[model samples]
Target: MSVDKRKTIFDKLLGSDIKAELLIFFHRNPSFSGSLNDLASKINKPIEEVEKAVEDFVKLGLLNEVKHYYFDPEADKELQNLVLEDLTKEESKSTFELIKDVEKTNIEVLDKLLPDGFPPSGLILILSDPAAGKDILSIQILCTKIAVGRKGLFITLDKFPDEIRDFMLEFGFNSSVFEKENKLVFIDCYSPQVGIKSKEKYSEDPLNFPNLSILISRVLKELNSPIVVFDSLSTLLQKGGVRSSLEFLRSLTGKIKESKALCFVTLNRRAFHPAILAASEEIVDGVIEMKVEETEGKVENYIRVFKMMRRRHSSSWLPYIIDVEKGLLPKT
Candidate 1:
């Protein structure tokens, strides 16, 4: 917009990416390695571009060379700057910058366009058809959090501990990662023993979310990560009707709003009513729809941020897919 900006390539570049597109993408996927091949396949970017881009990235100290693999690039710098160096007031500008950035964002996730960070702290809904890889999506998000040593709270209305463990093992996530990292945690809201409601009023406390709120709140207070997800809203509302579902979700959203976590709720379109969906619309920050359809004469999977109550929405569905060994990869 300015003559001076047009004259300078760096100046034009500074504000050109006025928004945080690349940062948000990596934030959504922190655990992923960014090897030349991996980054090319995962981002649908050209291999040569990835190599050139990452070479500049490493030279800038924005990324680290790890076992010949490139980190999220914005890898945690805070922990790395642990050694304290005495400083005086009004030192060199570089020294000032280094001292101030003691809490380095070593996360390979956030070092995108900005040297700062983009924190995802809001509500999200992931809706898909039954058996359409909803659980896999949840696992991907969970693994992303764990990769950065951040904790995850999975409030499941569907799967049990053993069931989830088995699922992750299929994707090469070892049980030690869960236990040692203490990253992945599950709140079994699906159990009737915790107030799921049976003939005798579901385990003594009838209106309780079957310990759903309790576990979620605890995780919120403890987790250092920005990501949190609910397995499936369908099961939470399974015993209740549409009105009850509306009330429960409304209350749940209110509770989630009080926390400092970015949240997501999974749903099946057929399992929910259109009227209830409309009623619960106010509490949602955004709705992301996942679908598999024939595109370019092939079956493709996509994740699109359809609506964002707080910000402008992405008009297109970003396509993504998973391979047998590589796991979830963003297609477009």
Candidate 2:
């Protein structure tokens, strides 16, 4: 006689066999998106029965209720792995765990703060002044990730695509190479705002929050866990106002988390109300702050991690310099 330890664990965690079965089904088919009827047909169960089971899982935090039911990306990892281990017993190891590995942010200084890289669907918020090197840091992150064969989606709220590409060239990142590979995409919100039709395939008015959300959702669906950047989210706040901008950010962050994408959003510290800034900071997984100060006629750049949830980080301010060719460099 043998005891099924895995089954015991699953039963204790889920408390029901149908819930355990659904967990395995969703793990094996992460891309499954259909109605209850469709899922019921595939699972060989009654529609009513399947709907009740799925509703139960959703209420229990195991499933997400979108247009269709799917496994929640933010679900408990240890419990998820335990359920998946039983389902994938034929394999030598679970591919689910491999796919869940953290994606590294390749910036040298920032990598030191985020030693474990980014957790799945990590949301980072950047607060800095115009001259504080925030944009340069973002470009460096995008370029490094793209160089490593990861896809990137740049939401340009403050610059044209050509201007951004030129800026990247100044920092020694050849954006054209990644653009040619179709692994890099730009949403030219800036051009549309200035009454100029953007030549880029994706362009939307910054004030049109719904359309911007739709465009981002479409782009994210085409790429697998790409790095998404909102260069100067302050433009959105300036144009849309605090209430509308916060609503838009809530929707945007929800989409990013559900897609398991790494997102970096930049906000100018001098632009919006402090209350809005505080609210924005509350919505993200981490916040990195930068400042520029002049002392004795020499301007210096400083950065620090203000807050990072569930990660160990040094909050001490670090001196750094923006190199014309190499982007951001730690001051010696």
Top candidate by lDDT: 2
Model 1 spans with C-alpha error above 4 angstroms: 1-119, 193-207, 224-226, 294-298, 309-313
RMSD of 1: 20.8
Candidate with maximal TM-score: 2
Per-candidate total of colliding backbone pairs: 12, 0
lDDT for model 1 comes to 0.52
* lDDT for 296 (candidate 2): 100
Output the worst ten-in-a-row residue range by lDDT, candidate 2.
Answer: 90-99
Residue 205, model 1: lDDT of: 22
Error of 1 at 224 (Å): 5.5
Name the TM-score of candidate 2.
0.68
lDDT of 1 at 198: 31
C-alpha lDDT (0 to 100) for residue 6 of candidate 2 = 47
